[model samples]
Target chain A: MTQEYQDGNALAGPLAELFAVDVTAATGRCVSCGDTRRVADLRVYGHALGWVARCPSCEHVMLRLVRAPDAAWIDLQGTLSLRVPLPPA
Target chain B: MGIVSPGFRRRRRDDDVQLPPGQYLTEDFPVLSAGPTPNIPLDRWEFVIASETGQEYRWTWDELQELPAEEPTVDIHCVTKWSKLGTSWRGVSLDLLMEDVETTADYALAHSYGGYTTNLPLEDLLDGKAWIVYEYEGSELAPQHGGPARLLVPHLYFWKSAKWVRGLQLQEFDELGFWESVGYHDYGDPWREQRYAGD
Candidate 1:
């Protein structure tokens, strides 16, 4: 079988619409497994509902995004913290 | 609908007879996950079979390799509408894994190394219908593909085959899994196009 899944880096486009910075370049600490990795390395699954980002270490869902017709839902309960680098002023 | 990329082209083979409804053929194996790629060392890996009643069985990575394994070529259909036919895998059958376990439960929850879990009827895992595969296409299964071990249940939608599987917990009652609770079909049958709850 082919490897059709993309990394968290693939979320840059969708994430850009929500955050001012590129979210993929951030680092996320998994709340369940306690492992930390760049958001770009997280496993990403794209579906019609939204983008689901999972922690590679424990496979716990760290983030869930649902883009509705008029609104969006973003859940980060699986993530203990997300470190996005600030842009230079 | 989103913008269609100019390079997007549907891949259809002339001899394709196994494609499921609403699915397209893909030569590529797409990696779909809800989390990060777990880096589990072989020495730390273990497979367990447990019952809600407190009985449990455990198998280390080496122990699993010593058991007899089968290489079956089967088609896999994903709930995401991608089907790959005749994919080959090698692993110990579920029959062998459950041979010594005694359980009266009618349902099971497959727990992965990561905290991911997917529920299924106990019967769906027995009768030579499933395997905990560690090898795919003649190589050690890649971590992205649920390496070390992944449950293989080709009859159901691919999501039922939990990746990076660690153990099976027999339950007296049915429990919804990560995707199941969110609207994906509980019993994913590709032939019937059961991708969502109402479908």
Candidate 2:
């Protein structure tokens, strides 16, 4: 299998965190039609150190950035963050 | 990535029913959801494959018909799950075309008139899995269907086999096409289910 992009350890943190099974999943709603869809369905393109998520339904792409990899959570005003559920300790 | 939904075929609640595979006309089926049609004639058509080094081969509607034709009955399983099985098509063979041009590139990009394009490696293009189609089910091809010509690669998800194909641009490196630029995988293989990138 071909390996994915690993040039910057920077993306690894966000990818792992975003894809973590337990994280509360987030959905980006279509601004025009009010259709709800998974944020991963949104087209993601990196801009500098940050990323933008574009809605496929309405083509309304949104941008956000988090400098620190591990923090409580990245602040997204209306969008919900899918958080991983912590295992029993 | 969203779950690559099970192919559009198996989901059909109607189990015993089947549609003979081949290009279907809009007049017969009226399935507008398939996509829009390109306004072009079946007779006045041509296909060109150009190498980056400026070498080119052009086949007009008449010139293409002059070549030997093959009739293939195959099942085309679209990633969308609408398998049109037992379809028949007649067109030029990849081997015959390769004989005309000396490709210095490792890959090729399928270029269509409506700015729709897709890429394939030289190995895949020559693998006998691909064909350039012009006639469907023995009838003159309709416009909604890839008329006059289209590329059919059965092994991969159907879209990699572009519709309304006009020519091919040989590339030394990989270049993403319409769906690939969006979220679709660069190389769409049905077995691997590489429908979307990062899946």
Candidate 3:
């Protein structure tokens, strides 16, 4: 049994339409475990059931996303805070 | 209609067999996984079914093959709205595996090797409804396709037929698995078009 998962880098493509900034470079704090890390460092797991990015420290679900033909449902109740980098004006 | 993703390659049309509601036929068995593919060596692979009473029925890779097996050709429907028809699989029926194990449980939670899970009512897993398939299309199942073995419950949405399957835990009460807890329908019946919660 392999306990491997894709890093938060994979979230880039799925979240691109929702955010103008690169979501991967942003950081999120896991509500369950209180672990803070870059979105690119979280463990991302996705399949036909849809995409789930869990906290690397506690495996608590930090993000949940299900995509349809025209819409994507994303739930982020597990995230306590998300800090994103802003570009210079 | 949804907005088409840029550069999304569309699948070819082939509607020979009748499909369930809202589903289109897919000629290829697309590889989909919740995580990295589990690398379970045949020697280390196993299957376990724990009854509500704590009795465990275990089947190792070798032992699983020693039992009587069947080749079934069935149509599979995915909650993602893709259906594959007339797919051939080789494996032992769940009816044979659950013949002796005692359980008053109403539901079961299937646990996978890569920490993924899905739940089902025991009624949906018995009779001639499910199997632990090890081969697909006459070839050894690949790792990406649930490798050494996977629970093949074609009647339900494909998610219930978990890939990288490891074991099952029978429950006396309703216990939602990973997908079910995350808003997907609890009992994913493709024919009924039960894809999301409250559907």
Candidate 4:
């Protein structure tokens, strides 16, 4: 069997059921403003099933994720989900 | 343009608009498209997923309804510093799209028009964790945004979630796409801040 995240869930399952607050065990700090937000709030926005969120205070938008404990070096081993945009061509 | 740093006081009007600490102008960013502008059209579009065995699943206008759909508000971070939030998208779920397809391999490669491709594990496509979005912000997704279809992997760094999605092919070995091949991290993880060819 493939090693699974804590939920043993894959990436394409029901959005909410597969990725609840438990998935985001780690914390994500806003890259822009530097405020640390809960992984769950950052992950879901708009509504319960929302995928994005805007910081109520700083207004800096962030790509949310369940914190990856071993984020120090992301290769194929880690689950990389950064939403940073591509630089201008 | 720069982004405001954390704790920076906000002004009511354009006062806050001055370059923030990390923000940059969109014009300075890379152009995302299918290919040369002329051959790509908003009306003509296609998305497919092929198993390592060569079995293929294709989506067309009429067949699109056969799959499941969803609306998600997401924050898209480019390797560049512009973070756009509250973006909405609708499309067939990757899990629903690959329901009938069989894959013997452990990995898959997402391919697009401009020689863009990204490798992902097979589990990501089968478990309903992602989507191939055809619509954005309540509108038909535009060409610049990988209209008709773009892979949305809310889990992995957005780059592995290929845009301008044309087909998905199961692969036994990992292959790098445009950004990955160049210098972006193979898998982009935001929390860790992995944003270059090599982290």
- Deviation in Å, model 4, residue A84 alpha carbon: 37
What do the candidate models score in CA lDDT, each in turn?
Answer: 0.84, 0.60, 0.87, 0.56
Across A1-89, the per-residue lDDT of candidate 1 in tens digits comes to 44445689878887888898888888999999999989899877773335788787767778877554445557787899999889687
lDDT of 4 at A48: 13
Q: After superposition, how far is residue B165 of candidate 4 from its true place, in Å?
A: 1.1
lDDT per residue as tens, model 3, B1-199: 4598787887545654568899998778877776667789889999999998899999999999999999999999988888898899999999999998999999999999988889999999898999999999999998889988999999999989999899999989888887787778899999898888878
TM agreement with the true structure for every prediction:
0.73, 0.58, 0.80, 0.55
Compared with the true structure, what per-residue lDDT tens digits does model 2 show for residues A1-89? 22211122233447566555522244445554566666555554342123434444554433233333233223343343333335687
Candidate 2 lDDT by residue in tens digits, B18-128 = 432332222231221112345666465678889979788988878888888777677665544455555778777777777779878998999875556788886787746
* TM-score (chain A only) for the predictions, listed in order: 0.88, 0.45, 0.90, 0.36
- Top candidate on TM-score is 3
Question: By descending TM-score, how would the candidates be arranged?
Answer: 3, 1, 2, 4
Error of 3 at A75 (Å): 5.6
Please report how far candidate 3 places residue A84 from its true position, in Å: 5.7
Residue-level lDDT tens digits of model 4 in A1-89:
21111221222232345444343433445656666654444423221111233333354444322222332211221122333233477
Give each prediction's DockQ, rounded to 2 decimals. Answer: 0.15, 0.03, 0.35, 0.02
In the order shown, the candidates' Cα RMSDs to the true structure are 9.0, 14.7, 8.5, 20.2
Top candidate by lDDT: 3
Pairs in clash, predicted candidate 3:
A70-B2
